[model samples]
Target: MDTIFYNVMMKSLRNGKQWEVLEELAMEMIEKGIQLDNVSYSTIITCAKRCNFFDKAIEWFERMYRTGLMPDEVTYSAILDVYAKLGKTEEVLSLYDRARADGWEPDAVTFSVLGKMYGEIGDYDGIQYVLQEMRGIGIKPNLIVYNTLLEAMGKAGKPGLARSLFDEMIRSGLQPNVITLTALIKIYGKARWARDAFELWEEIKSNNWPVDFILYNTLLSMCADLGREEEAEKLFDDMKKSELCKPDSWSYTAMLNIYCNGGEVEKAHELFREMLGSGNKLNVMSFTCLIQCYGRAKRFDDVVEVFNIMVERGVRPDDRLCGCLLSVLTFSKNGEFGSVLICLEKANRRLVHFIDILDKEEATLDMVKEKFREILNESVVEVRRPYCNCLIDICCNRGLTKRAHELLYLGNLFGLYSNLNTKTEMEWSLNLRSLSVGAAFTAFEEWLRALIEGIEHNERLPTCFAIHTGVGGRKLSQGLADSLSLHLKKMGSPFQQSEERAGWFVAAREEVVLWVRSLDSKSLLATA
Candidate 1:
């Protein structure tokens, strides 16, 4: 048969989704000495792409180029999408440049695919360039293109930009679909714009727009993060009521987190049981949230039980879960410590070793520090702060003030607590906002010693000094601030509570110096 006949037959097969047969017919055509034109190649490439046969699509695209028959815009877009799906950044860019040079103006579909690729790689500038080029070519962005851009902005955490684009999309006379609303919800969620997210969700409901699983889950997760227990419960109920959507594992996990954050352990447990009864497998996050809730409530037995269940189900604990387990150890009784330690050993051996060293009375500060450094180096960065806080809290509970100070110092050395102390020309401040109560006290003691040494050496101190113990939101931090106030009053320290600040104590330079002079050097050093 001639090339036209082969092309017609292949296009029919491609439309029927017969990808394998289509490819075989193409090979047969080649063997019969039939020259494949651009249409024939485009049909084959599009078919392979639709079937997720990315390698086959690339092969046919290369073959088309080798035949010296330039691909039209459709083929270019198809192959570009294939390259994008494969994460072939170099190939995507090179082909896009070649297409533009050949005078192919990409349509909305092409721009959407490119926007997705750029978004995945965190190249916001490239997405903007795509938008600008699309406008320059007089091709107004459709719903698909706008959805892609908004999704990218969400991932980039540019909520403002996403809002503007969403507004522009509506003004362009294209109705917002579920994908568009879902992207906007995600942007608001990521940026922590709770008010905006809730408002948008309300609008979505008022308009009675069709809501899918992703849209419902996105809102639920946002509510979980913002600790909007009422809002999350409402969203979860609405999701259940929707015939088109049901609570998946992530949905249950998010709702469970909301309950956990609100300290509604009974509700969390009820929902967790319901989730398991529905045959939705629990993930590490679900178990972590449950353990955290149990830890906070001082229910050590429940924490261990949930952990045992997680192990039985073969859900290997991650670093965050291990960190949560360590946190439980801080509140655990001396006898209860060993039980949590067992779970920690199963989760992460390094953490177990670190805890073991800290528990050992004979372990020197150097040994604990060495083990700490090793664990910090091996752990993911997000867990480092929590691990340090838990360890310092544990030490303080054990009356290991000196060891706690050394660990806090090592945390600073690792740049985990860089802003614990800050100096300026007008004010010198010690920020213990992120530190545990015990670590904060240890840091304050160290700062006082340094102040005395500086005064003895005639070093220039700031005109005013402030100690920040953090605000009144956290129970432990507020308790520390209150205790520090009482301690300062009992010692006749020069520092006085600032009337304007809830957690700040201030002292003038001369008062601080005199206070330091009056403090017995041996007594202060002995306290350390």
Candidate 2:
């Protein structure tokens, strides 16, 4: 009679609508002196996970263990779900090992979760192993398993393999769901196999599957990839009308890209403003399209304006964003250079301030980490190699060696490579106007050491040249110029006057060049 009552109570709890109701029922059962069995504990844990009450789920697991109850594969899988939600990959793996040790074979749900984890991390081999192991245990691969493996293959750059698997799954009589079709479309889209992509899209439409946001986004992306702006626009309009698929930031970004790349800047700008007014949280990618569009049109004032507003809105600029802005500065006419510089200077100062805060003695290491994470999340750091090079170049030109060196060090720590061009740009930007001959030589040596240190680990050593010259109307004295030339010649570096840029002495070694402006006749050399 008691066992029958226990089973009845477990069933009621399992079917409970809310986790709170289940918890209340469990407490009531405990007060009534009812013994909860393994089924009872498992139901509670599963319910807690479904409700996102991970902490409560963990407590129930611990309580079950304390009561000397062994967790079944279902119980362990439920616990793994909780850990997966918490993103504790190690714990998930650890529990998997424990389940195996306890002689509990994993079920399909367990395999699915493990496969999904492996797929996410691009561990194609692991995903395959999980699938094979499931078969070894007599568990047939389900549609979810096949879909996950296909997606994993695509992500791992084995699109051919992914397509083969998709065909295999279909032949095995497993119906490809919407997710399956989307993943296949993405693979075809990425490879620019337009025919295959369209074929798959036609299947989706023929099936009369409910058109959702993911499907529209995927199709729009495919159209964008094929440079079919008309088709992409039609899809976008259809997406707007669909009650099921509301436009979000990603969808907007894809459409914006289609317009921008098509040279429809006005349309892109109109959509951009609408996106802004839509109260969507714009990410860095969202702004990059318009920035690049303005840059392509040489509307630099608009480029700078957008960049300034991006920063003003507290959007942390990434390397791509900074690179876009730098490209603007690099191509800007001399008359507009100063204005661009002013905007860049403002942005740079803000970055420097953040760097300074990270250096404060009172800021704990953990706090520094938190701040760095916040900077990354908030879109303020310019960490891309090109952008870092641009920042380093500006710092070098402005005689901010400490800041430049710090940036170089940070770049190195961040695994940014110093390419030959990047190194040359830095050396080219080095100004020697303020340093005396002796001071200039010392500065040059320090710069060379720092440059070499930053790029030593790179697979290819880039030949670099430094062009250091006096400021406008100020040139190196004859004696100092000659001394510098003699030093280069003594070091086996070749020195010759550049016929093109007057007063410029070009010296070359095996991989490094030193360009010195000589005022041997007291005439100022043009800045390179």
Best-performing candidate as measured by lDDT: 1
Compared with the true structure, model 2 gives a TM-score of 0.57
RMSD of each: 5.1, 11.7
Stretches of candidate 1 off by over 4 Å are 1-69, 78-101, 117-129, 171-173, 269-279, 309-315, 335-338, 345-350, 373-378, 412-415, 422-434, 447-449, 463-528
Cα miss at 358, model 2 (Å)? Answer: 20
Taking the tens digit of each residue's C-alpha lDDT, what string does model 2 give over 1-528?
664575566567666647777788787778988788888888888888877899999899989988988898888888987887777778888878876877888887787777667767777787677767887889877887787777877777667778888878878888887798888878888777777777776776786754567877898877766676877777778777878787878889998887776778899889988998888788888788888777667788887788777888788866566556655554556577667656655655444444455345575545544544444454534444555555455444445455554554554555553321224432333444333344344444555554444444442433434444432311213434565567666655454546665435554434442222121112111110
Q: Candidate 2: what lDDT?
A: 0.66
All candidates' TM-scores?
0.77, 0.57
lDDT of 1: 0.85
Clashes of 1: 0
**Model 1 per-residue lDDT tens digits across residues 440-514:** 777888888887778888888899999987664223336668877887888788888899987799999989888
* Best candidate (score: TM-score): 1
For model 2, the superposed segments whose C-alpha errors exceed 4 Å read 1-33, 51-76, 83-107, 134-142, 152-158, 187-199, 202-210, 219-249, 258-287, 301-327, 337-387, 392-528
